[model samples]
Target chain A: MKHWLRIEAVCASLAIRSRMAYRLDFSLSFIGMFLAHLALPIYIVLLYGVSAGFGEWSIGDMLLLTGTIQLARGATSMIMSGLIWHTNERVQQGTFDLLLLAPVNALGHLLNRSIDFEDSGLFLSGMLVFIIAVVISGITWWQALLLALLASFAIMFFASLYILFAAITVRYISTLRLFEFQDIAAQYAQFPLHIYPSLLATLFITLIPLAVVGYIPVGVVTGHLPMIMLGSLIFPVLFLGFSVWYWHNTLTHYTSAGG
Target chain B: MDIITITDLSKTFKVPKRKEGLKSAIQSVFRRQYETKHAVKNVTFRVRSGEIVGLLGPNGAGKSTIIKALTGILSPTSGEIRVLGFEPFSQRKDYVRHIGALFGQKSQLWWDIPPADSFTLSQHLYEIPKQEFERRKNDLVEKLGIQDIIHKPARNLSLGERMKCEFVMALLHRPKLVFLDEPTIGLDVFAKQAIREFITYTNKEYGTTYILTTHDMDDIEHLAHRVIVISGGEKVFDDSFAALRKIAGVTKHVRVVTQKKVVLPKKGVRGVMHISPYEAQFVLDREILGIRDLVKAIAQKTEIIDLTITDPPVETIIAQLYQAKA
Candidate 1:
């Protein structure tokens, strides 16, 4: 584990140095991403201005949810989503064989292969919004701990999804459509579960666990979530483990078919 | 002393077959047909330690498929492969740590980063100790003489310079075995010589076993101790370099300048190119016709002006080997 961490550190250093070569472009991209995430909360505010959003949910509450989702997406987008994009490129270019030749796990190497600092801009923008919303709606330190724990599980849950998508890239070998599939799933985090139908809401909360990303975590802090939903957050960790196993299994099966 | 062994190894690819024209293309969207391409048949070979084996074959002769299988990049469709005492495909993560591979057409260096940064990544991946990594890296850089270019991004370097950096990266870990797939393709004479010298230095000093795949026979003549020729997805020839030449070298090229119209029997000689009736060129199978007997036979037919005989080039031998029935 220590060895892998060192490998990750070296890969991250290389990625930063490569980006630093084009400093202006890197800074501009960060600004662009932050602004894109910032647009979501502004749209929510505009919608809340005309009418009431979900039942008893204030504009500050929705902003808090959006900010929390951005932070989770930002952290994963930097490492995992970039991995899927690069995996598609590597498989097409045939450089993926190098990953197999390495002594480390192929998925682990891919996670470290692409680290876009520009994506962290979303986290910065999310932090600003979260701090403001926290000021608007005060919460206890214990509630903050619960939010942090849920955020970690949310991060892993999304990372597992990205890993599965990357594994699909290996099997299919070319898929620009995967981005659409991932984006469609992720957009669910933008809204509260109460707004979605019960069946779809139950699906995301129970099996997909996307609720921990924003809805449940924010609901807990706002005192809108029941104790039963909070207990379901533990399942995301299990799903993450299963995804890891599925990734290795997919690689083994594709070895016989892929170039 | 065996470092690699492959038994009846084969690979079959299921390739989507499509017919030409818009109608077939549209129909294929709903239903597609795939054909099995037998890239490598049941072939078997072995490599002893510290030997340079050249894999020689024509295009589509399954050389890359065999290399991929041996490197653990592709799993065998049937049979087994053991490299350095482990099954290559099943035990890939553990087995690959003891081996290294270089694909000339594919690069390992990061295109936008300096070779130094890429080397650092390799060092970390292989878990090389800092002091030992420095020593080996410095030695390879000195050997390749790339001190000035190592700091530049791989995109800025010439093809030769980038190839040298790749060599350094592959060797810093000192793997027990190395696979060189077309390592000298598109390289100039000087670069090829430098790479050959690197292979020799490492093989002699570190006892590294190398399996090279190349169309250039000069690489085989200059470096390989043994040659394995594949054609039609089967091993056609496997023996020492001299043995191959001797087996494929039985025929001699002969040219005869005659004073009169001499009819050389068509049954005794093949490829008889008659330049007018006074001169002709033909190949004589030394196994069947002797030079002394030919000289006497030709002298009796006419007053010969001059006669010359020489061995055919090595490529002709390999070309014939390529067309030989499996």
Candidate 2:
């Protein structure tokens, strides 16, 4: 784990250097992400003022869900977005061959070499919004803290899922459709899970698991789910293990492109 | 003991056949036809520790494929390969520590970071201790003349400078076997000379075994003591440089220039054939051609204004060998 952290730190440094190469573009993109997060809450507030509630959830509850999901997504993006882009470039350029020949795990090298600082703004904004929603909705301190911890773990799970998808792209050579699928899933994550039909809700909570990002943990904080469902928190650990296994399997199939 | 060995190693690729135009591309996506190409076919060679072997071939002649197979990037369709007493296809971590590689057209350096950053990362990846890493890093940077460029981002360096840094990066871990594919491809004359000299020095100073594949004839000519030529996925010749020249029918060309034009009879010349007008050029089989006699015969004809003898270019010899194989 210490070795992995060292590798990750190296990757983060490389990523910062790469981003700094295009300083103007990186600055503009960072501002754009900040504004984009700011706009999301404004839009949600207007919608909630117009409607009484989204199913059983109030405006504050919806804000919590949005904030939690955005925070998780932002953190995931911060850590893994650059890695995804680098993986695609490496696969396309056949530089992945050089990485494979190196004296380290190729998957670890590919997945941990870069981080995006732009998304940190979105993450910070989401954390602020989550705190505001917690204060406004009058949640207890311990429940609020537990929800925050669960949200972080859920973000990690989502990141693992994204890494798994990236690994699949490495094998299949295209992930645009996967990106589209994630976009639609993000739409569902913005609202309470109760707004969707039971089967669809189960699908989100189980297979896709975007519900864990905001819906399930928020549901627990709001007392919507029974205590038994809290046990499902263990799924993230299992999913992480499975994603890593899948990544390794896909890595074995990797045939780098170009000379 | 042999450091690397291959027995009947082969790799066949299934390449999809795609038609031009957007409509056909979309239509064929559901029903694509794939043709199997035998990239490397039943090649077998072994290299002992501390040997520098050159892999010489034309474009798409399976040189890179063989290198990839040896490095565990590509799996062979059928055959067995062992590198440093480990199966490379298994991609065992212990085995990877024994090998290093540098591809000429591609870089392993972190593009937007200093070469030193890449070396540091590699040190961690290879799990080298700090002192040892620093020692090796300084030695290599100095030896490769990349000290000036080591602190510059890889993208900012010239091709030669970047290649120098790349060489240092590949060797920082001190792997026993190094594979260099076209390591001097795009450099100017001086840079190429520098790289060649460094390669020689590295092989000798560190006792690192090298397997280099290059299209540059001079690269093979200067650095390779033993040359292996592969044509059409098969090893056509594997021997010393001199032996390759002899086996490829490479000969010295003797050009005789006379003051007056003369027609020579083709029949009675002991060491000459394929003669042309005002100047006659002869192919001197090293065994048959006595240089003094050839000069004397030329002198007997009209006035010998000038004479120059030269060996066939290496490219032509290699091309002729390829044509013969085809």
Candidate 3:
């Protein structure tokens, strides 16, 4: 418990420092993100006006999904995206060797020591949507809150997956396709998962498991998924564990490129 | 007892050969070839507690490779490395607890944060107790004279100031074994001297065992009691400074400036050679020259304005050693 607290304190301090280093950039990014979030609901409202229900769901249900996904994505972006960039820079500059020699868990060091604050705006925007959606959709208070927490964990799991992919790229140095795939995945997450075919919907739930981020949990909360789909919550924990394990093994194979 | 021991350590890397030009680049992407490069080959050494040893070598001489292997950052192709009685590569966490490493070209501190913050982070990373961390940090900061700059961001500090802070950061945990790779690179003379003094004081005062790699011969001369020189992945020379000079046939160069421009005799005097007009220099050949006679001849000159003598540089001696081994 003490070690975990220390990690959290250190990570938080690093994030705060990084944010303060570029105050103007931080402010600009936050404002831009807030405006972007407001723009998204407007776009969705226009679409709903032109068309009837987005694939078996009302406009209110779609708004709830949008809020959940935005919140999860915002939290992950704020916390874990910085780690991906840090891993890449460390590998290229050969600074990763310094961390490897420290008497600490390498994955813990990398994941906790770096963070980005611009994503906080996204989180806030998502929270606003979440509150509005809960009021309009009439979700049970306890169940809705529980799913919301689960959605956050799922976001962290996906972020860890991104970090793992970046670490692998350090070794391979040629598998840039993973990045392109992530960009496409981001676009997919922007909309409701039901619009996609059943095969892809299953793929998103199982293979990538992005559905758990906001879609599945919100779907379960809104009565779209039966209690059987509560099993999806297990995916985040299992996937996070797998990512942590892969990170340790892959780090051992790190041959620092230069002196 | 030896704090670090390695046997037949070797590391080989597979480097992909990429073709240049737009045409060849596209063609080679599908049919890529790789060549194996041996970074460290059959290299072995041991460092006892409280010894400051220098790993001397030129660029691409596998010095950094060997350091990385010892630190458990890179697994050797084949070898045994025991640091603090544990296999470094297998028991990295346990082994690394007794070690601290600093690469001069890298900054372990967060660039945008104060050094004090980085130090706190390190304290937690190493699991140092609160009281112990404070005491050690205060002592190190005081000793290194970085109290004034500890709160400033690392990127805003000068090179020397940043390096001083880096040194303090590495040593705050008080590890028994320290590896410093080019710790004084790009620093001015004053900063370099400060670092050298600190390393010497730490080795003597705290009995810290250090394995330092540097291109600066002066650093080796000042701090290293023993040096291990490697070339082309092979250990070329490993011995004391005096012994290395003797075995490499390296000697001092003495330039004697005469009061008048006297032409040296056609038949050169024993133990002395006329290297330039009016400038007579002596190479002490154990076969023919004696130091007393050389000095007596220079004294006989009308007047000697100033004379200087210096040993051949370590770089030259190292180059010659490599050539001889080749």
Native-referenced TM-scores of chain A, all candidate models: 0.92, 0.91, 0.88
Q: Best candidate per DockQ, number?
A: 3
* Model 1 lDDT per residue over B54-172, tens place: 99887778888898889888889997899999998888889989999998878999888899989998888888989999999999999988999999999998888999999998888
Report clash pairs, candidate 1: none
Query: Alpha carbon lDDT of residue B147, candidate 2?
Result: 78
Give the per-residue lDDT of model 3 (tens digit) for B1-326.
Answer: 88888999999988888778998788777887889999999988888999899998888889999999988888889988988888888788778888889999998888988898888878887888999999999988888888899999888999999999998889888889999999999999899998998999899899998999988767877889898997888888898866665666635566777877633332223356765556777644432444565566656755667676655555677777867668
The TM-score obtained for chain B of candidate 2 when compared with the true chain B: 0.79
**TM-scores, one per candidate:** 0.87, 0.87, 0.87
Q: Write the per-residue lDDT of candidate 3 for residues A1-259, one digit (tens) a residue.
A: 5785677678787778857889999899998987788677778779989988677666777778888877777777776666666777788888878778777677666767656677788889988887887777777778668868777666866676777776786677645466566546656766668788999998878877777776777777777877777687677778877877787788767789777
Off by over 4 Å in 3: A174-183, A232-238, B249-315, B322-326
What is the CA-based DockQ of model 3?
0.64
- DockQ, computed on Cα atoms, for candidate 1: 0.44
Q: Who is ahead in lDDT, 1 or 3?
A: 1
Worst 10 residues of 3 chain A by lDDT: A174-183
Highest-lDDT candidate: 1
- Please, what are the lDDT tens digits per residue for candidate 2 over residues B67-180? 988888877889999999899878556677888899998898888888888888888888899999999989988887777888888888999999998898888889899999
Tens digits of per-residue lDDT for model 1, A1-259: 8988898888888889888888999999999988987888888878987987777778878877877777777788887768777988888877888778898877888888877788888878877777666666576657656675677777887787888788888887777577676567668878988888899899888887778778888897788987677787777788888888888887765543232
What does the lDDT read for residue A159 in candidate 2?
71
- How many pairs in model 2 have backbone atoms within 3 A of each other, for residues 3 or more apart or on separate chains, i.e. clashes? 1
